[model samples]
Target: MAAPDDSEDQDALYVLTAALLTPARFPAALGDDYPESCAALGLDPYPGGYGLVIGQDSDGARWTVVVDDVSLVAVAIASWDCGMEYDLSPGERTVVSVLPGWPLDLAVAAPGLPAPHDPAPEPEPSRDGSGQDGPTAGTALRLPLAPPDTGTWGPPQRRLGADEIALHWTQWRDRTEAEDAEATGTAKRSEVAKEPEVTQDSEATGTAQGADAPGESSENGSPSPGEISHPGIRRVLGELRAYLHSDTAPPLGRVRSGFAPDGARMLRADGPGWSFVARTDDMAFVLLDEEPGEVLPVGRGSELPPLLKALDAMAVRPA
Candidate 1:
């Protein structure tokens, strides 16, 4: 298949966390030009895990360089160990470690062909020879990391182990924004007091950290966010391909994962549509089609059974 076209778009890569972060203070903390820098590097500054690469941005001061791949931004979130409600300000430079789908180049660039024993088999006829409406096997996007530019920085390895992949950072700043309403020198100190303990169990399921995942870095200037904070979660990068393709109970695609630092409520997207949203401790919501505003509450996580039932209902059928 032909690669996605990139000639028409004007977006750049390399988004400064400041540009993308909200509740507004993030921009002040990082810098005003951060979003512009993100555009220079082909990064989409929009909120949430999904982002698109358009070009490169640099003025030489804040967030110098990087490429933007939507999935990668989500993965980067894990590396930052940005807990469910924690501040992500410390992760400004962490984007450098995100290398786009470079390792899967061979597979991605390869021509499409049917599998061996590849002769097209006739579809089994239904009751009156009509084709059955069984689920059709299809391909999902599996992007390879783009090769890093000569001077660019990136993580050392391409994948991670199980437990190591589950790490994430969280803080309840938003929940406590009201508490800091009074005279405050800087809300930083008070934020610490209000910080909620992120029990690991609240994360999306199957996000176990991989103890043996590799931990190599290309530059010493700044450590990869996950390396310093959530090494195990960082390892999940290594298992990206596996997670997408594995025959698992609750198959998933891009998901806004959240968890208590302890590993309890693992939320994940469940769907028949191409998109789904599942937050571990909150709720599983599916946006089957946005044009029509079709939304549905698949399950709830506060109580485990409802969550599991929702997940089971959403699980992909085994081949």
Candidate 2:
């Protein structure tokens, strides 16, 4: 996995943070699927995956050091998550590519470094839209990697929204129950239990998800009286069902499962223009590019329960 040494006279990278670029887990902002995500970083979709070490070089410029040492980076991330310190200095032999800038955002900076910024530009021949201008193509003029713009509704934001829902599934679940009770004119289910009501802005997940998605209304997002069926929902469901078949399955990691509370499995799946998040034992939420900011709710009825089971059966999980 070694790369041509284009980084001449570069100082040691002061590691700030790191992330895994793998099939089962990756930064969703890059792409919906593993191959697409690797393409975004100009790397091969190696089954073993790559480790993205984000840090500032001696020059105070940000760089993403892509290394083949997946286990090392994984351990570092685990240590950080546990509030333990782990030095993540990859061996020079494991260096794959040293890319400019970061594909993901990081608030932390090295103590003594100046503000994080892009490296000095040394422009090479610009390429056509495809980026293959000549034999000199891909010869180390690494462009600064930037996070996808999420100011408006798009694929990047849609994936991030799904991430938030998964991250705060319990809050959303409680909200769904409340919404159903409100729409049905029945006493709230939690009234006897007296569970605190949750709104989208629930500190559980950072930004305000609000009661409804930005463009969504009760008429579109809840299963209270009758969950309105959309053509897009039907389309996405069909695609997901197709993925269950061996011959029709999507790429690796397109369908993935993660740990959930109470013996449930959290499922996150993405496709051409949509992302789906669900719990194996609960209902699912659908977000589509065509329908901006709307998070359509799918009830756990006759079909959905079985479908979610099938998805979990074939879905990949963290090792």
Candidate 3:
């Protein structure tokens, strides 16, 4: 694929945004785990992880420059999060592979560049769809990287819903409580003290985390979700238990732990067709491919609290 040089010339690669492709952190569009994600980009899953520097070449063709220098990209992301401008330019030596297109959707684009787009495919060596040249063969062409379709609900979309829930946990949590209150004919909001916010997103989100499901109240006086005999939730909980007892889950980052406000640990776990997000101190929201665009809440019931603690003990944490 075409790439630009380090010169501050007009033809240099124009940096737009970046992300980490590590065991604990990666775009959901790629895959649920590290090895699967690396395979999607045709790269090996190295222990140190790679940094994806998404940008446009001089022609405004989108490119994802994979680099080995994870710290450089990490620092740039941190700086940008703090509203500080830091020029993100990965050194040539750190460049691992220059992928064809952007994996995740981006709302921002570089100014003075043509709209970000995939570079036109180089004409393929003409070959019929016979035994040697078919899609499953070695000579077949590879498609450019792109984000998953938002119109459909699948594994990628499921993970994305989980991501949004984790980002807007407080909004979902409060709404869950309010919904439970309405269901039980009581005002739970006025009676309870609010804790520190888990995370927030200003972006408009109408998601599964807000879905109302049938569940009994926990001893703590909050609705306990997923304990209802919903088949999907039951299957998910079963799979989670397998991960703990039998070690039957994916090894490379199917479950991860992140920092949460007020000394809580935010957990993100993904399975074949579902995603799970919760806090050790609070409830959980599950998104499943079968349900399609709906999040099911699981409160801190007696069973769930211990399960969450076990998962947290096994989850991978950011260094």
- TM-score against truth, every candidate: 0.23, 0.79, 0.80
Clash count per candidate: 68, 0, 2
Candidates ranked by TM-score: 3, 2, 1
**For candidate 3, lDDT tens digit of each residue in 1-319?**
2244445476477888999999989887778888888888888999799999998888888888999999999999999999999999888999997777888888877886778999765433335646354453455555678887776878888888899889888998888877766865544354455433333431233222332323445643454654456778777888888999884655688899999999999999988888899999988888888788888887687688889999999988887
Report the number of the highest-TM-score candidate.
Answer: 3
lDDT of 1 at 109: 17
lDDT of 1 at 163: 14
Estimate every model's Cα lDDT from 0 to 1: 0.30, 0.81, 0.80
Steric clash pairs (candidate 2): none
Query: What's the lDDT for candidate 2?
Result: 0.81
Candidates ranked by lDDT, best first?
Answer: 2, 3, 1
- Candidate with more favorable, higher TM-score: 1 or 3: 3
Top candidate by lDDT: 2
